[model samples]
Target: MTDYDVIIVGAGGAGLAAASAASENGASVLIVEAAARAGGSTALSGGVFYAAGTSLQREAGIEGDAPDAVFQYYMTLNQYKLEASLVRKLCDDSPAAFEWLRSIGVEFRAEDLYMSGVDKVRRGHRAAGGGAAIAEALEGSFAGRSVDVALETRVETLLIEEGRICGVIVDGQPVRSSATIITTGGFGANPAMLAQLYPDAAIHGDQHWYIGAPTCRGDGILMAQAAGGQISAANRGLLLLTPGFAKELESYVPGWLMMVNREGRRFVDESIEYSVMAAVLGEQEDRIAFGIFDEASRMASKTTSYRPAPNWTADRLDEFVAAGTLEKADSIAGLAERIGISPDVLHTTVNRYNDHVSDKADGGFFKPASFLRPITSPPFYAARICAAIICWTGTGLRIDTRAQVLDAADRPIPGLYAAGETTGGMFGECYASGGASIGNAIIFGLTAGREAAALARLHAPLAATS
Candidate 1:
């Protein structure tokens, strides 16, 4: 009755990689995806792969970059809030996983390598054609293989025989399999799941938006949970800071703009990384902050630079003011009154920052003198910024390093495995890096496929007898 040795739900980067890997190991594999095409949210991404101790690093003239370094940095970044065992395994096997992708025709250029997340060492490997290219490469990897893809098909139910997951129910029919892997992507497109799990983004209301594909309905998590899988209990995900003035993403606040908390006090350097910056904003009053800048700074922001603000242009500022999204006043106290803050505190904060500008230094947060500019001109403006852009959700089914979906009691759900965004335990309070999502998908997808294949091999005799 077993139709395939392994059945993978969702054909994103993880599902495709899993199908190819399982097929390569002499296991019959079938990839079922709901989308018209195979690529999932990963195809809509920038296509960066985060790894350590790879030939790409060596070819780029960087040496001594290893998994040990990644572990140290990741642990410190998340304060060890994540499962240490899983992170350690991910770091250890990252290089091998990356090489496997390359062998499958995914092109990564040494020149495109750059520093991402909080890593002092460079680990972001940019694909030649961005995320679409990586998706194409992963899809192309199916060549000359026994991997079958069922596109535009949603997995209606996870069919469990007895206490073990055996296969799935699609279109009212039971498709038996030795093992099932969930890689159906995240719940970003699911508003109900967003409000329940990611309250931080939910608070943004209309400002919030997810960059992933709309097909990410979180069906995998729900289906797995129905099969006794434990869902992750946390409100964690990657969010980008934005003016909420427009839908376009604004990752970094220009250093020239001064940021103030609810009490009109400066808290952090404006030029910090988005993941780190968003975390700091959550600590502020009401999880809100304001970007304070003048006409000069707003006008100068239009000049092409590494951190260009397409939403912060002079015209946009005027539009925001005209639309009342941005508050403006000739005096600092007046601006404070409009924004509902103490006039005296606003006045003092501005004066202190102006003093630092005059001294050509950032005595408060040391935000680099080059980016420090005094905002003394009339008609000062302040725009509300929030961590609204939902890049990836962190809440999903919990899994071990072996990619087995665990139950509420921390026991593995037999015949079930998961990888990619559908599974949690990879991310913590902070998103590890730019390429962590894709890297996680391909890496653990590779693991899940092999593990499921090994399981199928073990179950062959029992299936035949039954």
Candidate 2:
């Protein structure tokens, strides 16, 4: 006889979500997490939930946002390289997923709804207390549910019989079950996976680093691959730009800081979302850009909230310059020469930027007036920036709209399901939105749980398996 009806590998947002849905569907659940903690990368995230038609949107007076609109925007932004049916399922179930997380004690404030991507829609719902709160809520759910959590216990392998998954090999022992859901997170921490899956970010060597949980070692993806599941295309995760001024996570560059490409020309609005900024920067020469700002801007900068500008504060700037991390010069031309750009083009770019400073309008990029600042003060500074920060790897096992793991032939592997970062094909080229990953985790985790539960109900619990 089987020990449980459904076995969930990893205890991240997706795994916990799967267990939640499976238990509600009358399946006995077992959650195995490799780390001492339960949340995985979800707990370390910003806790934003990217969703449309959410109750928070209406409460915040944001209208004209629906699942279909979200679907179109996502498909358009990614250039339609994603799996349409799966994307549709994610879009349609996002609102319900939002409500479900709320029902489980996670908080999403209406006022916290903000624009999190290239789209103007305010669909990013920032949960109170960030990802830690959402992770806590999901883990706390174990108190009332029929879930057995095995911490610091990694799944050795997916146990298969008759070409179907039956359970798992945990700690060299067999744990029999009717169905298994793989929710293990990404592989940003693994150097082999980084070089193999994400070459762009891997080129930076030691300069590159991951922002997710250290336990995100791609355990679930590897197991699925060994079980004959397919791996999606590589280089698909969100990569953030950084100046290498210490590994401190800097998501947004200060609006006051101007960026110039190799030709010493401005390319982006400088204040756009990180995903868009990274994508745009990736197209730049050598996928590199430089942040230009004056001494005054750095001195006047404060630690910002809506967008973090901690690295630009006067003290931090001075520290960086002293450490040779930031190049300093008494004039703009001198700064351009140091950064290896044409001084003439840099002069023209600065002249036009200064001309509009009084009007508080960026006529070229149309940057918001509130963030505009003239780089007129003496002693200009520049820092090298590249989109090298690996947020969460996008290469993983392939799954369908129903969260069922698919083999090389795109056929579903019975009793095998996957969700969250463990499953690939959710993201296309760029990360669609801020909360897209978390939303994917919760929505597909819920789906995988229910699907595995149904599959388990039909089976006699892996009866008499050799």
lDDT of 2 by residue, 1-466 (tens): 7889999999889998899899999888999988898998999999999999988898998877899999999899989999889899999999999998899899989888899988988999999999999999987765777889999888899999899898999778899999999999889889898889878769878889999988888878889999999998888788888999988887877766788999999998988888777789988998889989898887898886878867778998899999999999999889998999999999999899887788888899998888788889989989899888889888888898889999999999988999999888878777898999999999999999999989888885346463
TM-score for each prediction? 0.95, 0.97
Error of 2 at 443 (Å): 0.2
**Model 1: colliding residue pairs:** none
Candidate 1 C-alpha lDDT tens digits along 1-466? 6999999999889888888888888888888999899789999888989999998999999999999999888888998888888789889999998898889898998988888777777899989888888899888887888788898998999999889999999999999899999999999999999998878869878889998988998999999999999987678788998877877756666667899999999999887667578888889998888889877777666734466677777887899888878888888888898888899998899999999999998999988888898798787899887888999888899999889999999999999999999988878888888898898899889899999999999999987888
Worst 10 residues of 1 by lDDT: 299-308
Model 2 scores a TM of 0.97
Off by over 4 Å in 1: 303-305, 463-466
What lDDT does candidate 2 reach at residue 391? Answer: 91
Q: Count the backbone clashes (under 3 Å) in each candidate.
A: 0, 0
lDDT for model 2, please.
0.89
